[model samples]
Target: MNDAHLHMLVNHFPIVGTILGLIILIGGVYFRSISIKNTAYFLFIIAAVFTVFSMSTGEGAEEIVEDMPTIGHEIIHNHEELAEKFAIVLYLLGVVSVIGLITNIRNHPKATFFSYAIVAIAAVAVFLSTKVGTSGGEIRHTEIRSEAVNQNSNAASPKSENNEY
Candidate 1:
């Protein structure tokens, strides 16, 4: 498969993973469960790793799709910018998660602090994920673009028989 195809395959996990990790981490905090919190941390780390893969493939994918019909440098550039921000958040989450996992393992008093910090970071990551995902989708899905949607809506509206032109 080409870079674009590979990118499509691997790009979603980081978004979904951050969301899932946040939920799991919140549950862990609510229940005061170390294991659950660790699980969330693991997920974040995996998500961060996947982010690397996605970023690596993105340039190649751009090379392929940037010139395609309905796809151009501007859309890909927007997606790239958002993706970069999202990647930084995910990477920070991963590092913090590692610290959290270690602290929990050693039963450090600061473990709780890390957990809360992770929750906050994960929340940011989740927010950024939505933007990144939508921008990425817009790279290929013109139907979802605001201008395209507006044009389609206007064009698709029904005309009344007695309506003046």
Candidate 2:
């Protein structure tokens, strides 16, 4: 398969994983369970790894799609920018999760701190993921574009007697 296909395959894990990891981590923290926290950490690490794969394949995907008839360079560029920020947050979350795992395994005093930190970072990642996903969706899904919304609104308006929309 081409890079675009590969990118589509791998790109979703980071967003979904981070969201799941965040929920799981919150549960772990609420219940005060080290084991659950570790599980969340593992998921975060996996998400981070997928982020790497997604970022690596992104350039190739862009090269392939940039010339397509309906795709906009600006849309891709916006998605790329948001994706970069999202990647950074995920990477930080991953590294912090590793440390959290180690500390929790050893019963370190700072394990709680790391848990909270991961929660905060994962929250940011989740927010960015929404923007990145929407922007990426706009690249191909013309029905959801801003201009499309405007056109739809205009079309839905009540017609005047003069037959002018």
TM-score of 1: 0.93
TM-score of each predicted structure versus truth: 0.93, 0.94
Error of 2 at 55 (Å): 0.4
Q: Distance from true position, residue 117, model 2, in Å?
A: 1.0
Candidate 2 per-residue lDDT over residues 78-141, each given as its tens digit: 9999999999999999999999999999999999999998999989999998898888888889
* Per-residue lDDT value at 88 in model 2: 93
Which pairs of residues clash in candidate 2, taking residues 3 or more apart in a chain or in different chains? none
lDDT tens digits, residue span 37-148, model 1: 9999999999999999999999999999999999988899999999999999999999999999999999999999999999999999999999999999998889899899
Candidate 1's clash total is 0
Number of the predicted model whose TM-score against the real structure is largest: 2
Error of 1 at 102 (Å): 0.3
Model 2, residue 2: C-alpha shift (Å): 0.6
The models' CA-based lDDT, in order, is: 0.97, 0.94
